[model samples]
Target: MLAIETKQLSKSFWKNNVVKQIDLQVEKGEILGFLGRNGAGKSTFINMLTGILPPSSGSYALLGVQGPNNAVKKEIGVMPDYSSLYGSMTALKHLRYLSEVSGKKVSQSRAMDVLQLVGLEAHANKKAGKFSFGMKKKLAIAQAIVHDPQLIFLDEPTSGLDAESVIQIHRLIQRLHQQGKTIFMTSHNLDEVEKICSRIAIMKDGKIRRVGTMDELRAYYQSTITVTMKHAPIAATDLATLEPWLKQVGAQLEMEASHFTIQVESEQKIAEIIRALGSYKIDIYRVDVDEPSLEEIFLEE
Candidate 1:
């Protein structure tokens, strides 16, 4: 089943089109990484999906129910990019109030369970206003999932977390996914999305520029292979011998002490270069090939 679907979804404010025609879908039990640069309409699209902002034109459905319908509202949870907890209330109290508002009839035990799940149980009695930024973010996420919604939308869930807290949050998200929950999250952190998302939609200028698995995107952006080799230090005379071989393969080489970095079109060229180097009886210690990161691909666009 599709957990979420949109067709020609769009939104406008005043005379500006914030979100242009966008078509997207998320399958049940899948993590869809909604990626884009700032002002690229990621948040606007997310808002439309959650019904926080009505689409100017187009259609959408959440968990099989058409939009502007409240039937599936209870089945979806949303954690926005910004924290939205009541500062004056204690963490426990805030969760209780939200539970009542959600009409979930949750008990203190349930609230505590969620707090612990988010690693905030120790601060349950502390006023939310006194909590640190990371703690507040955790509290917000806990509140979003207290009802055990079938699908969850998390926008920059790790935005303010410390390194340890970020790892903890990633693990928690993975556990939720394991339990058959579908997650649609927006993030500017490419590394985080690469680690957690099954598929990604890259947006730019209010439109989806590309959508695919990480491997697929990487293949699309594949450039020359970067090969770094650790070899014995070279002299002016030895360098002349390497120059002819480098010219033969049309490879560019950079040298620093005992290291040589070569850029070649493919692995076959690397093998040829290695063979040429071997003919010179030069010893090679290591060879490393660097591939383009998702950030590289996004920036290139």
Candidate 2:
């Protein structure tokens, strides 16, 4: 079952199009990482999906129910990029109020349960205004899930969190997935998304440039393999000796003080490059091939 679906969804403000004809889908129990550079319309799209902002033109469905429907809204949860909790209210009160507004008949125990789930139970009685940014983020997340919504939208949930807090949030998200909730989250941190997301959509210029599993994105981009070799310093005169072998294999070589780095098209070509270098009597002390990181793929686009 698709927990979320959008078709030709778009939004504009003051004649400036922020989101342009986006189509996306998230299946039940799947975590879809919505990725983009800032101003790539990730937040705008989330706002539209959650009905926090009305789309200028388009349509969406949440859990098989069409958008702008109050029935659908009751089953959807959203943790925005900004904290929406009441500042003067205690964490416990804030959650209880939200649960009440959700019409779910949540008890104090249920509020504490979500607080514990988010690791904020120790500070439950503290006012939200006194909470640190990370703690407040946790509170907002706790409130979002208090109603046990089937689908959750988290916008930059790990942003501004310490390493431990980030891990806690990641684990909480994973646990939600285990409970069969669909998650759609936006983040500029590709590494974090890469670790937790089952699939990802890369957005650029207000349109989705690519959407697929990480392996699919990597394969589609054809990541470059960098091979580093430790060798004795080469004389200016001897540099020419390595040029022919490098040229024959179409490898780009960069020389450092005592090492050479060769970037090739793929890992399979490394053996041939090694053989070519061996034929020239170049002592190979070490060879390492580095795969491309997510940053590399984004920049290449």
Q: How displaced is residue 145 in candidate 1, in Å?
A: 1.5
Highest TM-score, which number?
Answer: 1
C-alpha lDDT score of every prediction, in listed order? 0.86, 0.86
Task: Write the residue-wise lDDT of candidate 2 on 218-246 in tens digits.
Answer: 88887566788886566565677766667
Q: Estimate each model's TM-score.
A: 0.86, 0.84
Task: Give the Å shift of residue 250 in candidate 1.
Answer: 4.1
TM-score of 1: 0.86
Task: Compose the digit string of candidate 1's lDDT tens values, residues 72-189.
Answer: 8777888977756787999999888886776675789999999998999999999998998899999989888888889999988998789998898899899999999999998878
lDDT of 2 at 108: 92
List all candidate RMSDs to the true structure: 2.8, 3.4
Error of 1 at 190 (Å): 3.1
Q: Which pairs clash in the backbone of model 2?
A: none
Candidate 1 regions off by >4 Å?
A: 232-243, 255-257, 271-283
Candidate 2's C-alpha runs over 4 A off are 229-247, 254-260, 271-287
